[model samples]
Target: MSVFQSINPYSQALIQEYPLMDTGKINAALETAANGYHIWRRMRFAERAGVLLNAAKILRAGKEKYAQLITIEMGKVLPESLGEVEKCAWVCEYYAEHGETFLADEQIIAGYQKSFVTYEPIGAVLAIMPWNFPFWQVFRYAAPTLMAGNVTLLKHAPNVSGCSLAIAEIFKAAGAPEGVFQSIIIDVDAVEKILSTPIVQAVTLTGSERAGTSVAAIAGRHVKKSLLELGGSDALIVLPDADLQKAATVALQSRLLNAGQSCIGSKRFIVVKAVLDDFMQLLLNGISQYRQGDPMETGITTGPLARPDLAANLSAQLTGSIKSGAKLEYGGRFDGCNVMPSLLMNVQPGMAAFDQETFGPLAAVVAANDEQHAIELANLSPYGLGGSVWTKDIDKGISLARQITTGAVFINSLVKSDPRLPFGGVKKSGYGRELGRHGILEFVNAKTIAAEL
Candidate 1:
């Protein structure tokens, strides 16, 4: 009886209302997905790839439309929204082209005359995704899972319900069979019930640590495999020998992109004390370039926070950190969800901005005594989804990178997720991996077969 409403963050206007699926509809969807999985799993790898490739084609053809939907629905700037669509298409194409090779049987030398490991689909997989990068997150999981021969059931965030349905429509238009990919318009309770079903075999989530823990617990209870890509307080380490200009440029972009809603966005800037003042000046200048306005406008560099609550939460973190000794360097002005690009200096381990994930246009700068201290400060966070170490010396950078505790570390570069690399995190950031060969294999049954010649 309850209806879900989608609101445009920028205009604060109601976009659409979706009625919840009742028990009967939910049962029917599960049954359909189960049936589709049976057919999908039996198809040749080439055949499966063909459908995914077609989906990619559809995404490309409708890029503009989907980009507009993303901007209007979630307040992503127009350019970034378009880039998100392009990235989603890229993932689809990447998986369509390489998934079969990644999932191929591996030969093993053992006592048995013939032995091999085969990857087999594990029926329907439930994907619970977030809204920040709505399309990209879902496609990143779906492209590989579907290509690996498993059908997908997406439980996307409620705020991006329209984008969710649009993605489902794209798959259908690309000739995906009825339940190969279905977007369920349901609540959290419905998600738990669906996961409890026998047909849904596994789960993958990209959201908060709290959400990941809850879903992981449910999956554990049912003995279903789960992959979680949760919250991140990624540290951007800048050493004395690093290029401060380049580091500042990339750091600001990484922190401010998507209005700083990204999980892997650099939340803490760990700078060596020798170059702290210089890097601080560059960081301030870099932050000055961002201009927040209507996301649909072309020249606008940033947009409003996805929701008012998110803005308020980030504000609390900012005020709390300032009161705790972190000095406000620049830009802390906010009206509703439209927050100014802000920077906090002299941030220490105990400050709220340093301790918690500030998911908005706020950057925290923590001074480190030296290279070793920078690594120490970077590893100090409870959440370690991703981190980057900036240093001109490759060997030193690589050495320090190994010592940092995180999912993926980049040397002299920003942290990002690519279809070619396995991405995830340790600590409270969640477990398991997504993307690359590891992702396709995550939801599959790696059965070992041995036989006598």
Candidate 2:
């Protein structure tokens, strides 16, 4: 059978290799999950919560080991990798405490004497996740779905196969029964075969628009529910009256974090003409502070892109944007995956930087005539994922935020996913929500019952 190798993006070291599972192994896993779901679904909420709580403890105790693995495999800075592990633990704790209540039955006043809507588990859910923030993405989907009594089968990115197996082991050590949570090492054809199986009930994907579309089409063909969290070119709007220094600081942090691999990372900086120059200057000053090196080493503020291809793609986009009239302000050079954080000024609607999602440490600045023009520019992208509006006036911020068509919009702050809030996007950015009450309910069947008293 074929094998998948996990390599360190920074050092170019081979971390581990995984052999692909064949048809027999795949069938066995599906059968086990189908059997395990029956038992898991019947368990009490407190019992399920116990398993998740134990998983949280395991994650916390092994944070350093897991964090190091993330850094080695995905090229995230060591500190950020540690933070991702901590966040994964937090998600587990959040669901363990609130999942039952989030999925609790809702009483309704109907014609019958007693009527209510109950949320029940939908069998096995297939989570197809990306490599960027690998641990966080998996836990965010697993924590709630498992708590809601649904089994999970993860098809993680091939480059992070070691991480995928590590997570599965964590759940196993935390007292999860076999097959309740399994990371299957399989190919794309195998994924299609699994999705076609009757045992796999639903699907959730966090990847590029192309991958999302392909998975969604297969899920649709089988009549299985699908939740997609896809690509984004989110706008970071800076109003004239906003705090320039704070905006610049947050903007740089949001864009450069994970070396700008985040789907919700601010791709377009829409600034009002009045304070554009000040914001640009402060942004440049902030960019100068970042230092890129080995992700495992200390004192490195930024790490390389996850792979060489990602860096090359970002380079092409930067070159095309510059050719399309956008000016390269600073730092456009890259050594393999180790890209220097770059900035592009005079970015307009037609330029690659402004029009496409740049999944690297490249920032694009677009000038807006006024507040209305800023909102218009923000909504111009085909993507409607997360966005941010920077303004001191809460009322104006809220009003302008409402005008921008996206999933989640933050005022005076950067956009991010929180366990307490629902997260997803609109239009080509994909559909359905994750996290909070909505997320817990995504894989559950909301059954309405009516009976006479």
Candidate 3:
């Protein structure tokens, strides 16, 4: 059988090895999931909530332990890893508290004497998640999925196999049924086999554009629902009236969080010419403060990319963008997975940094003549993920925010995912919302019933 090794990205040491499940094991898992779904679907909403609440307690109790796993396996800074674990617990608690209300039956006025719409579980859901924000991504999906009475099977990124198994243990410890949640440490080749099986009723993927396309196609062929959260080149627009210092700080934070491996991180900075110089100076100051070192250290603000190939790919993008008329403003060097928090100026539409998703600590700045031009520049990308608009005028910020062609927009703030709000993207960044009331509805059946009195 094949094996998936979990290696520490920083130390370059193997931490653990997980054996990939064979055909027979995979078949057995599917059968178990199918049976688990039946038991989960029949349970009361309160009972389901109890399991999730227990999960929240468990996550908080073991926050440090779980956080260490994330940092060691994925190279996220220690503080950020701790934050990610806390956020996972929050999502579980959020769904546990509000899931019943979100999926409550809706009364409808129809010609029939009685009419209503009921939300019901479909079956087992397969989630194909990425390594970046591994814990947050899985819990955001699994918490709601389980509360909605659907079992889940996680096919996490191979590099984070240990995280995947640990998640299974969380559910198990929280008193989940045998098949209610399972993590299958299988290769990409097995995705099709699992999706084709009758037990999996729907699918969700958080990955690149290529993976999203392939998974969506397979789900379509099987007549199952699919939700995708793909790559993004989100724009962060700074207007003339914006607070240059604050904008620069938030921009730097968003661009460098998780070493800029976030799909919704502000990859493009569209600054109005009136305040470009001031904003750039402040941004440079913040960049100077970042210290790259081991992720486990408390003082180090920057960590290595999750893999050497990722750093290499990011280096190539930086080189290609610089060659395509983009100027290297600051910091353009790589030592293995440790990037130098590079910044590029004079970036245009054709440059690789502006056109493609730079999944590293590389920031691209594009100049705009005015607010109108800034809005226009932001809309030029095929990605419509989350973005932010900075302006002193709240009304003006709201007005300009409406013009950006993205899924979610914030004014004078960094773009982020919240349990209370819906999150996802449009265009090539993929489709379907992932959180809030909309999220629990994604993999459920809205059955309509009408009857005479």
Candidate 4:
């Protein structure tokens, strides 16, 4: 058995090492989750909701410790990691408060016939999450899935093994049954075997493009449900009449949040010619002011990439962008695992950074001739996860936003994952949502019941 070491991205200190699970433990967890689902799905809506609500309280009471583990494992700033924990709690409570109503039986009129749709659990759901927001990503899926009467089996990033077990413990403390949600310490190679099991009915992944494809293929082979939130080259569109100052500020935050490791983070900035200069200036100024050092420090706005390889890949992407005619405006160098926030200009369509998802502290600026060009450039990529269309004019911004071929678009705002609204993307960004009513319903079997008149 191989024991993988977890390190703090910021301090470059080894946190701990865990022996990878063998076949026996993986099979046991799968069996447990499958068996637990039978009784879990039979529970009353209110009863299930109570488990999730209690989990919310458990999270809130221990937010500081959970946040520390998250920061130590992945280099998320303490404040931001705390915010992630707080958000996790919110997701838990949200489902607990509204799940019953959301999943209630729905009546429908089919001409002369009457029909109703009843939501039912789909047994054990396998959640494969990333390290960027370790706790948040796992809970975002777990809260709703558990509340929906389905059991969850987590396969988290090995680097964040402690956080993974911590999450499962919290749920257990909140009155979740023995197998309601289990954290499996298995490698990617082990996923297919678990997926092949009889009890695992669905899987949801928040991970890299490669991981998404691998999991999706396995899930497809088994004819199971899959929700994939894959890589994104999300565009931040700034129009002529846009508030340059606000746009630049939001753009900086959107690209830099989670140390620039988010799926929906803005990797490309599409600016209309009229405001290109102003937007570029503001972007440079904003990037310069970001505080970077130890993430454990109270004021640091940025942290190292989750690992050294990620930083190296970021360097390669920046180098490739420069080679492709994109001008490196600021912060193009990488030291160890810390890559400073970067801004690239003169980005053309064919450049790797312009079209591909740059999962680091790099942003490519593509100047557009007009609104049509901006929209066209934004849609040029094969990935269409989410984007923001910035303009002061509400009607015009909303109209242009509607035209963007992304899962979600914001007008005069930044792209975000909200539990209240539907989220996911089109094209190669992968299918299925991770938030809102759509997310809760994603893992359920939507059955239609009919009664003869």
- For every candidate structure, what is the RMSD over all alpha carbons to the true structure, in angstroms? 0.8, 0.8, 0.9, 1.3
Error of 2 at 250 (Å): 0.5
In candidate 4, where is summed lDDT lowest over 10 consecutive residues? 1-10
Backbone clash count for every predicted candidate, in the order shown: 0, 0, 0, 0
> Residue 109 lDDT in model 2?
94
Stronger candidate by lDDT (1 vs 2): 2
Clashing pairs in 1: none
Tens-place lDDT per residue, model 4, 94-131, is 88888988899999998647799999888888899889
Better of 3 and 4 by lDDT: 3
Comparing 1 and 4 on lDDT, the stronger one: 1
TM-score of each: 0.99, 0.99, 0.99, 0.98
Off by over 4 Å in 1: none
After superposition, the stretches of candidate 2 with alpha carbons farther than 4 Å from their true spots are none
Q: Report the lDDT of model 3 for residue 54.
A: 94
Candidate 4: list runs displaced more than 4 Å.
111-114
Per-residue CA lDDT of candidate 2, range 1-453, in tens? 499889889877888889999899999999999999998999999999999999999999999999998989999999999999999999999999998889889999988999999999999999999999989999999999999999989999999998999999999999998889999998778877898888799999999999999999999999999999999999999998898899999999999999999999998999999999999999989999999888878899899999999999999999999888999999998998899999999999988898889999999999999999999999999899999999999999998888999999999888889999999999999999999999999999999999995
What is candidate 4's TM-score against the reference?
A: 0.98
> Candidate 3, TM-score vs. the true structure?
0.99
The local lDDT score (0 to 100) that residue 88 gets in candidate 4 is 90
